[model samples]
Target: MNGRFVRLGETGRARVAIVIDGQAVDALEGDTLITAMLCSVRHVRQSEFGEEKRAGYCLMGACQDCWVWTDEGERLRACTTVVEPGMRILTTQPEAQWATLAL
Candidate 1:
């Protein structure tokens, strides 16, 4: 499930390190946050309700299914935000730390 979406004969884009939960993942330039995440991970976040893993439902920003947090705790919609180099991201809200710890 972790792979790049390369068009036939297309050259690779510049790689950037996008950190998720303190781990680094390679992402291509011009990739949205969700696209970059999808290249390395399966889910965008865990649901607060039941700790269910959630991926993006809407590629656009209208749906709230693809929200991710900055390391500083600010939330952003992953499908609309472009990935940047050295971005420290957290895949779930800080409140969801308990679910992660339980894993």
Candidate 2:
């Protein structure tokens, strides 16, 4: 588990489980997707253009840097999305279709 942000004497906050890259991670009920990842995930996504890594920037969802994907090929901004129970998320870009690949 990654480091937590809990304050001393804090208690009774509900937890919601979200699957990131096939791994289950716990997030507080009121947490935004970025906040959920910040509580446990070390990195959010890999840059598609290069090998650089990404976490999050502009917590208000203006930068568009913290996007994650779902199994159904839908993408959502992590910074503004809220955590929901049994939600499946993928930090990496989904596999490209064979027809989309160059010969």
Candidate 3:
């Protein structure tokens, strides 16, 4: 185990399970689903057009690249959100709609 895992605090990380591309995964404690998704592959971000080099921009929930599909059918930004138990995350494709439009 990495030193970090051994020293997790009250804010300690816990292993949360999430589904990636239909496969179940146990992420690091306190680790976001996006981190878990990234472990499977270098770039977790995806576009409907299936671009391979997509990446998250403002991990603070300001950018659109980290968007992912949750099991509940809602799309959300990944970086600012933490992973929960039983979360099914599909880190693929672009959203059908953008809440805000920029010209």
TM-score of 1: 0.82
lDDT of candidate 3 vs native? Answer: 0.62
**In model 1, which range of ten residues has the least summed lDDT?**
2-11
Which of 1 and 3 is the better model by lDDT? Answer: 1
> What are the candidates' C-alpha RMSDs?
3.2, 3.4, 7.9
- Winner by lDDT: 1
lDDT (10s digit) by residue, model 3, range 42-93 = 5555676645655566556666678777756678777767877888766654
The residue-by-residue lDDT of candidate 1 on 30-58, one tens digit each, is 88998888778778888867869888897
Ranking 1 against 2 by lDDT, winner: 1
- TM-scores, all candidates, are 0.82, 0.82, 0.63
Candidate lDDT scores, in order, read 0.81, 0.78, 0.62
Clashing pairs in 3: 9-12, 13-29, 13-30, 14-29, 14-30, 48-94
Query: Least accurate stretch of 10 residues (summed lDDT) in model 2?
Result: 3-12
